[model samples]
Target: MSLFDTYIAVDWSGGNDRGAKPKRDAIWACAAGEEPVYLRNRQVAEDWLAARLEAEAGRRVCVGFDFPFGYPAGFAEHLTGREDALALWDWFEARIVDAPDVNNRFDIAGEINARVSGVGPFWFNGLKREVNHLPRKGLDRTNADFPEKRLVEMRAKGSFTCWQMAGAGSVGSQVMMGLPVLARLRRKYGAKVWPFEALDSAVAFVEIWPSLLAPSFPGGMIKDAAQVRAVARAMAVMDGQGSLELALAKGEGSGAEGWILGVGAEDLLEAAMKPIDMPRPPKLRDDCFALPAGVDWTPVDEALARLDAALRCVVGVEQVSHTQVVGRVVAEPVTARRSNPPAPNSAVDGYGFAHDATGEGDQVLPLLAGRAAAGGAYGGTVPHGSAIRVLTGAVLPDGVDTVVLEEDCSVTDTHVAFRGPVRPRANTRKAGEDVVAGSDVFAKGHMLRAQDAGLLAALGVDALPVFKRLRVGVLSTGDELVDPSQNAPPDRTYDANRPMLLQLAAAWNFEAVDLGHVRDDRAALKARLDEAVGQCDVILTSGGASAGDEDHVSALLREQGNLQAWRIALKPGRPLALALWQGVPVFGLPGNPVAAFVCALIFARPACLKLAGAAFAEPQGFMVPAAFEKRKKPGRREYLRARMGSDGVEVFASEGSGRISGLSWSDGMVELPDGAMDIARGDLVRYLPYGSFGL
Candidate 1:
């Protein structure tokens, strides 16, 4: 029913095959993405592969074979004739994407003739095609002594590297070869390379067995294997695995070579890229639109428009309790009922009295009678040259203008000598001087920050009601996905989104509950959904949200709920599905871990907060440039993962949503919109702080 039934793998070597040697040199067999089927010996592996292809007549299959389709012809001339004879042999390996005629052999016999007979003499004339090859004995196509001599020479100096784009002098390898580049990549790109075994397996699944007789595309990277695995796991957040898978399936392209992205996107991208041990430098491509054709590039209004439209859906003016006011926007116009410090009591700890009330500086006015503490009033008015005692925060008598400190007045027989000349309003606080009781305190619809909270406390409010936190139910699917809490195999890792989602929900005022991860099977997912609908106001699931052959989320929704949106044109979170289940919004996030986290931040986080009665704000990416060149498809918006770059804007690198490093390293992500921007190096852009992920 699919394009290919089975895949084949062959690890090829120079000359005839490993059978020509003492041991097995080729890894030959069937492999979908794992162990190969090992059909026979190196040389024989090809024949067995040919037979397998023939056995499945008319059906197309993918086969993975290891060999440099072209090699240095001097290897053959070195075996049989003089050194100058190398001129008669032509090099035959090197390739460009889809440029088949450049070096591919016309047939097996022709390849043998070219190698053993030095058929393409012109290749050696140009120094560019020099290569190292080994031949086997008794093989009609090659001289028996050639391989041994070549190997000896290789041991002495030259080394043989597999013909992946890495060794092809491609942009990626070029960037990787430099020490500065390596440091930058690790510091910036992190690890995003895939292993030979993994790549071989993916190709094999496509039944490239016929390729056993041929060479593979040799598209592997020179990065730490462990990092590659980690990136793959991270990529699970978004359901996207690698460059090829996302390119072919979602048509979301990564056509650039280098890029600097905001931190958030970098984290999301890291989650999507396959993990490796150390960071590897990636070559950038230009399959996207550069900012305008010159300088003066500005953000397209449509992008802002899109952002605004989305925001409008959930943002609203709403009244909220002062207790619940922290971080919530005030929707109504608010005014302070009274000014701060409504009345002036005492500025110092000393008694209050009339001006010239001090003896030294202020007259020491004797304590006639203590004025009541705050709120109690003095009944009678005072005469000229008089003072009254007042404590801190106490109400002064009606007749008292001010009170002099006891040290300032010479008190004798109730006649306190007011030393200094009396200034009517000097020491006394006039009524309405501290504050007018009718001023506005705060406005409505404003986001309440910490200072705002303090203001409310000062206003005498102890407990308050805030907008209720949104309650979100979390779920995941796929039989391959497992609960990380329990033990798992070498291939298994714990589910990451549940905890991440919970944290994000908390940050955004959404109450998140873990509903557990499930399998791709419909019945199980449905059962989980049924449980979720009863307790949660919003339902969120990671994985099984795409349209893969085995994916079942859509089918389950059709059977049990109402699906509103299927596939989105959005990058990194393309497989996102939105629906209404039992009147509660359901966000079927992509199964890929990276996509899940990013999408949750994008849609689910805001939606949950809005449902919880909190004002909604959209999270956006900044428009920084490529720290390095980045590749992308022409049409869809690409989410590139990058670091907070030393430059302070963003430094773009690997972790392209296909890699986990993108999400992990990024403080935020840069939006590589479809037509206007390329995220090239040194561009000014909007910096979207990791917006509103509750936790």
Candidate 2:
């Protein structure tokens, strides 16, 4: 059976403020099993939908609005350095203003176009001739950065680009004005946006192109309530046929480039909804966590400092051969086994002679009788009138204080002549110059690299003392989670957090132990903890830390061990729970994949390093201009997944923590600190690259 119990279709507008009556320019809404209604303004439309959604919180509902859910992927990246569709709404919300008689949709569109390229791609400005930025041309040269069509635009035949703001078949104005209303709806009710955030048990907002359904409605009912009613009925039919999901299935570039639900499902809608042979995944749970009352929230810096202070390195070191010690932390300082070279040598292919052998007027000297090579040196001192032939790296002959380059001298079998002045020891390497005897080559806590190992080998050190690798136990705790290898029942999901964490641990050079999954029951969690406490230096678990009925991880920790903190003043990763179980450190991460990944890198990486007898690693961030704007409250820090672009770093278009795709799409994160608000375009912000975290 389809999860959704109701379907709603809305015909959005892009013109000036909504009309007082049901007109072509006003917002129109119709729901399956209900009469079509005309809303006078955006606010009323929002209120009407909000009321219905509030009453049906327990039932699944899907609302489809006739507007572009997101811009073309390139425009989003160029303007905001983000591919998240919801972020583009934030960009519009800060700039566009909607009023009954007038709206700034055209102005906003022009502003965005100006930022995209010197010449705007959005053309055909409205009746107002004063909006000089938009050209009147039907087609014009476009910026390569901003493509004319979104992925859906190319896929759906006869579809119009969301860029057209004026003229016939233009939905651009509706997009600018409509997005803010949708943003409010999503924010007030925490509605999931399809293809970005996962479908919700309560409600989801999807993008629909009404024209795709218009042909199904008979003639004479082209552009009014009748058309909306017909479209709503079509939705009901599609839903009943079990083809709604096929339409809702993510299309190519659906997240950043919006897709029209049911755009290409002609024959599929004719079939009846049937159960698939494969096992179904679990229904999504709304178990978001926040800081508990009466508990003081810890700042990120302070929390890290406290964690490092409390963690002690795991004891025990192993002696490893120098060649095998690469990437291992040194347990003790390594001193030079012997002085480098053990004797003075030539720095270049040159001649060796006494510094004062040449007279003031006679710069040329007779070729020396003795010759010095790398392994064999001249035994006796050279005569004052002669010079010795010494190749590069050859030991200096006895009584030779200087060496001259072969290129600077004209040489024959009998004599050598100088073209320039030669300084004493100019091309000579003194004994112990590279490394003196007993000098420390590498200090304790230094992670040995290939070059360091090679240098140690050169010094004849065969074995080295290095700290033993720390063992990390990874666990996934949730009744709704199942192993991917197993056939999961409905209401269960394949575990993703455990495998991801295990892979990350391996990359960080830790001995990762898969502690496996635990049920939500307190006893099951306790048993898993007991099994892991003695086997690993650190334990990491995903889920079961929230204040939900099924959550047991936090409760078990509070009763059996120290439950230090429940949440940090951070976004996405706020629900982190830290504890100590039988003296083994435990990190309880949020169940959301993105949240789990971010928390692991931010909080877990440093803690693991400290436990492995390595120096605390502080990830450095670079400052870059924000391609998009954001308005947020002060106090808590927020991290938006982003990727580096040719211009600057762009954030992921969506902020849904449930969207695991964001982790792979993003190269790093953009940090908004406490008290940060209103990030205008081109504002400097701190960017943390994933590579900086040693990933």
Q: Top model by lDDT, which number?
A: 2
lDDT string for model 2 (277-299, tens) is 23312211112122335768777
Q: Considering summed lDDT, which 10 consecutive residues are worst modelled in model 2?
A: 280-289
Per-residue lDDT, model 2, residue 257, is 76
Worst 10 residues of 1 by lDDT: 254-263
lDDT of 1 by residue, 574-608 (tens): 65566666555677887677788777776666555
Error of 2 at 492 (Å): 2.6
Report per-prediction Cα RMSD to one decimal.
31.4, 27.9
Error of 1 at 111 (Å): 99
Write down the TM-score of every candidate: 0.45, 0.55
lDDT comparing candidate 1 with the true structure: 0.44
